[model samples]
Target: MILFRRRTLLLSFFVAMLVFSMYLMMSGNYPKVIYRDSGVPDAEKVSTEDSIDSTDIESVISTNGSGRDFFVEYRLERDRLRSQEADYLREIINNPNASQESKDKAQKDLIALAEKVEKEMNVENLIKAKGFEDAVIILSGDSANVIVRSEGLSTKEVAQITDIVTRTTGLSMDKITIVERSN
Candidate 1:
């Protein structure tokens, strides 16, 4: 009975987090990306390259305001998505009518989800410790995307970030794509 109550509390906390994140996303606190039909040819559109220059970011930020932090918004969105996934897993685990097999799978998934969250947090902290102003990392299957808050990254800086990600995430250098988010 105590265990069940604890699970209930945990579920409630996650639900609250999800709701708060959604509110932030919907409240116009962050810049919204607008797709417009400029007469520019598709071939002449903004480069979709990994390195997003300050000019690119400035144009995007111009729509809303200057004080927006891309890293913070990305982190909030990531947390919101994870929170929703966790809430669904919790529901499956807590459903009394769920079969044992389904509950077991849900429990396994939940543990994996927690581990992924912790690993991402650790990687972010480690990156910041390396003197970055801010960093956001997203790990998927065998690939990881590391976006750092900077106008540009030197070769050495890229090496440092790549090493940190490879060491922390066990992803090969080729599989990790590092990008710069200009402040």
Candidate 2:
């Protein structure tokens, strides 16, 4: 009888403990919760109404008044046209069915179109002509250098040719260098 009574008491104790644990969980007061502090500064405590001390307002005004916004828009348009022209050239070069004759004709047509565009836009004509060997224009430190490596042209002749090119391009004569290579 004593063993039975002890067993009943132990069972009742376990049930009470379980109910107490459930109540604590449902009430949400068993585990202490902690919150992290946000690192933002209080705007109300900071002063931001200070006046700027700068004496370049007049200079800024003068610089800003120099040109219309249309100038930038026109430059963007010109850049777009140049990009399109490059794409067209690439397409022409990559066409497998393009014969040598057709390619030559296409190149001539492209140059004419480019000249027309240059005249209309007041852009400098950078490329004059291309032959069996490439003609390169080298601009180094305010000097224009034209180098052609092909056929029978002496160093002196190349220099003279470069001078002529500089004169025709309206570039400074002192800044132009021409080099030619003979095969």
Candidate 3:
């Protein structure tokens, strides 16, 4: 009878301990704002899984790369700057003081640059839809640099990326470089 009582007491204590532990785990320093919507439609929100930060990105690059990180944000900022520059150039061309030759040149450059940037953004989104945790594509003069978060990559994965980028940009494989991001 004594042994039975002791066993029951120990079991009760363990159950209490488990509940306490779970309570502690459930409580954290972060606020839970994921489900609350403040009037904007879901489609308009960038939804880079705004909850994730950089360190989280480095440690756990999930299969989905839509999560916002340094690279994604940087790409966004770069795109905004490019758009602004084009707008500024348009203003310059519209200025009464500008020469006709200058306006013509600006118009041509803007058309070419706009097309390239738009293509790059489209390719980036296509790659992201493939389930990469985070992807960054930088298009320089002749080649493109792509960085993706993943523990590792197989030849097939690289080939998949090449296929996507090629289809979007019409760029040959030689000019496309696939790079895996490291901590």
Candidate 4:
């Protein structure tokens, strides 16, 4: 029947889009190089003056009162809220008293949420793999906002990020906004 064929076609289209987006994210055009400074010295023996206090190190590593901490906390909070939403949706789907229409809507919403999460993660990872220290992307209704860990972004960096977001979310370059958060 036409309806069955149409559904099949749509499913195929979505699958292809997913595959293409993943390919773009994993492409060798951008090399993956992670730069990390452990902040530890090579010398095992340390002078008393040279050794930093444990409390000082805790302050440095603590997620409180720091600019870089914002990203980690934000991600944790976002994930928590998303988990709550997903649980509610699952509840609605499982409730025997729920209307079929409501259950169907909840299922669609859950699927959409999953897709959005995937796209956001893909964009974030691609941006970081491109050499950013950290990045966060929120894909909301026709627009994406990207925050990167840097003092500022060069034109080329902006273009690369825009390309990743647009390709992953299928949004226009104009719909993507890139901002920097200095450490």
Q: Best candidate, lDDT-wise?
A: 1
Best by TM-score: 1
Clashes of each: 0, 2, 5, 0
Query: What lDDT score is found at residue 117 in candidate 4?
Result: 71
Sort by lDDT, best first: what order?
1, 4, 3, 2
RMSD of 3: 23.8
Q: In angstroms, give how far residue 136 of model 4 lies from its true place.
A: 0.3
Candidate 3 regions off by >4 Å?
1-68
lDDT of 2 by residue, 15-89 (tens): 564585468458753233232335232454222321111222222223333232222222333344444654565
In order of appearance, the predictions have TM-scores of 0.66, 0.26, 0.58, 0.65
RMSD of each: 9.1, 35.9, 23.8, 12.7
User: What clash pairs does model 2 have?
Assistant: 143-175, 144-175
Which residues of candidate 4, in runs, are more than 4 Å off?
Answer: 1-68
Candidate 3, 39: how far from true, in Å? 25
TM-score winner between 2 and 3, please give it.
3
Model 3: ten consecutive residues of lowest lDDT: 50-59
CA-RMSD of model 1: 9.1
- Compared with the true structure, the alpha-carbon lDDT of candidate 4 equals 0.67
For model 2 the local lDDT of residue 33 reads 29
Q: Which consecutive 10 residues in model 4 have the weakest lDDT in total?
A: 45-54
Worst 10 residues of 1 by lDDT: 45-54
